[model samples]
Target: MQHRPTIRFHGAAGTVTGSCFAIETAGGLILVDCGMFQGSKTEKELNYRPFPFDPESVVAVVLTHAHIDHAGLLPKLARFGYRGPIYATGGTMDLCSVMLPDSAHIQEYEVEQLNRRNRRRSRVQVEPIYDATDAALVLTQFRPVRLRQWQEIAQDVRVRFWNAGHLLGSASIEMEIGQGRDLLRLLFSGDIGSGFKLLQHDPEAPAGFDYVVCESTYGGTDRLDTTDIGRRRILAQEVSTASRHRDGALIIPSFAVERTQELLADLIFLMETGDIPSCPIIIDSPLAIRATDIFEKHRDDLENGDLLVRAIRSKNVRFTQTVEQSKAVDFVRGFHIVIAASGMCEAGRIRHRLKNWLWREEGTVLLVGFQAAGTLGRILQDGAATVRIQGDEISVRANIRSIDVYSGHADGAELSSWLAGRLPVRYAVFLVHGEEEAMEAMARRAAALVGDEHVYRPRLDSAFRLDADGPVDISQAGPPPRIDPQQAGHRDWNNDYQTLLLDLQAELRNAADDKARGVVIRKIRRALEE
Candidate 1:
């Protein structure tokens, strides 16, 4: 008898970052969304570790989207000698063309900064996970696949794409594996988008399948909205009011891709219709500006597409691609709006912009998307009075407000509604890509629809055996770095660096007032001198 088809949860089993899963069968090996681990500094170290499996052995790959957490590791995977073809939509490939290189630049830049500090402390220097050249190598492997078209990727496995409505070229992958007697259907919902998107359609519901893998981001509850159309009306009012009264800048920390373009559209529409006065709008993110070019190239592909195309071309909008240009904006800026990236506030020009604008009462920090836990964005959203940046504590006096209307992920209701159409799911339903609470809550809600026995939330690196009947847990070694950190669904890290990191993280988390701490240190030094 043939061995049972097995699936391994390599990444994204517990956390929202590092989305990777592998499936093995008699035909061969297949992988989906080899993404990088993200979030706190401790969590990101997982990206430096070797892949759980041999990259060269994988026959083919299907990328779900171009977001860093979903497709960021492709460059790293390729760097390790994986020469296989990567399957993605044209838009995904195009976005990755810019995004992967940008991620590589960050990796290189961060490593340089880290080493400079480490050198001062006489600590060992570390290498970046991947560089821009490595990212370029991965780009050569992407093969574009059109939406809704079925293409066989392996001996007995065929795959098709359906728009996920999360990001450009995002999709829900439907797969069929095996011959007449052993045929099995599986679906991977990469990231599901909700209604009220500015330019994209609603997420496509899953079709009938034996097994389904779904994302549970925003699983249990909903992000409260601040405006009707992605908070554009509110944004207009805030910008117009600030432009007229305060004469200070308005800063929007946005995701460089869809969020930036959507805001441009809404702002243009509002200003053109006399809803608000048109102040100079400066796009300070280099990545966002390149992505805008890609958006214009694909204008026909979006809803109200040409309108934004025209809006971006207008004289009031400025794309700052060089540091000189970005810096130049500050000199002439009076009541202008600066949109920057790293939506979660982990990195990017947004940090610099935030540092300069956050202290001014006249300026406002308008958060336009989800801010992950433990990130600077979340700290600001939680009303932090002060935050340390680049070794300096910065005051946070600028008004911080978030509007959830720009989110790309579906909420609890939308997830349930998406599943409502796929009633009577024939086999196991696995939930990944969410926090522990979210996954568990979604499990509870899904149990009411599907039998409790059929719903499974696999932990990171957990193994499962699948056949015609259903899926069952299998005993196997967990994925590499299977447990670590304070976040839910933690995998382990065995390196000494991790041990040292844990200690440092504890100190940071438990640190006291800076001035008082310095005084205490001086007192100890004086006592030692005596």
Candidate 2:
């Protein structure tokens, strides 16, 4: 008897980062994505753990995009000895060439800092997951493929790419396994873009599949559909209000790939058209600077590509590619707009900018994308009065604002519409890459289109068998999950410890006298004893 194909969920099952899936066939094994985890400490720690499966066993890797959460772990994969062909669109490959190396640099730099502290405290040292050499080596394995074309990746396995519209080269992968009578059709909706995106065309894909795996990033929420003009109007209002302060700075924490480029275009347009004051616009991220050049290189493929080209070349816009230049922004006087990277404020130059300006009443932090739970951006959005960054506690006196018009992921309604477009799913629809609530919410909406019995929300490390008829739940046969489902998207103990420290400081500060402070400390000591 022939062995039926099986798929295992390694990451992005219960949370919104580290998107990886393994498919096993008679030919061997292939992976859809090998992404890195972000967000909470628990989630990010999963990146340090070994991949659930052997890297050498993977025959090919079909990358959906270049986002760190979707493609960040490629260098680590290469470090672990997987050197097979990693397939992606030409645009995705271009973005990854720069992005992967940047990610490695961050790893090395952060680890270096961590080791310094560790050595001072007599703690064990930790090594980076991968280095610059590993990142550069992985690029040699990437093989670019065009959209809407079928390519045989492994024996009896053929794959095709569809425009996902989320980023420059983001794609929805379509696959066919086996041949003739025993063939199976599957589709992976790799981060569907909001249809109202300003940069790329609307997402497109073929319909009628045996099974489908979809993303639920914004599963339970819906937003007003903002057109390009409407989006620009909203941005203009924000810029106008923030720029009114002569000494204030407008700081935008953005993703380097798509969000940064889109913001630059709108900012430049608003400045040139006199809708907003012409303040100095500084691109303070080296990754974003390199990404913009890639965007310029692929301008002909984007909607209003000419506008982005013009915006990048605008005389008022400045690109700061070195650390010295980024630090020089601190000395610039008057009102200016600075855009930095790591949209979640988890890493990158955004942290430094936040540290410098978060205490100033005139400064403004404008968040333009989704802030996952436990991220600094979410903490700010949730109205935290103070925050700790790089071991320094800073008061959050600056105005914290957000605008959803620039989000790349589709909202709930748009995601459902995208799912509805792909009808006649014969087997099951697996929902991944979202929080628990989001997955549950999306499951309900998806059940209405397909039957309730046809939707499945697999936990991390869960595996399923795809037979000729439908899906079989074989998750128990697989290894246990690396992280508990309860802890996936939520804040970890580190966050709790930080909160405790802040609360203790506040309590001690508010004490009326030394006696009262001693009483507070005794209560804490008694609780610890208990």
Best-matching candidate per lDDT: 2
Q: In candidate 1, what are the lDDT values of residues 341-387, reduced to their tens digit?
A: 88888788888888887877877888877666556787788887677
What's the count of clashing pairs in each model shown?
Answer: 6, 0
Off by over 4 Å in 1: 223-230, 240-245, 475-481, 485-530
Clashing pairs in 2: none
lDDT of each: 0.81, 0.93
Q: How does model 2 fare in lDDT?
A: 0.93
The residue-by-residue lDDT of candidate 2 on 1-530, one tens digit each, is 18799999888888898999999998889999999998888888889999999999999999999999999999999999998999999999999999999999999999999999999999999999899999999999999999999999999999999999999999999999999899999999999998888899999999999999999988998887578888999999998898888999999999999899999999998888899998889999999999999999999999989999999999989999888999999888999999999999989999999999999999999999989888999889999888999888888999999999999999899899999999989989999988988888999999999999999998889899999899998988877888788888788898888878877888898899999999999999999999
For model 2, where is the 10-residue window of minimal lDDT? 221-230
Query: Cα deviation in Å at residue 516, candidate 1?
Result: 7.9
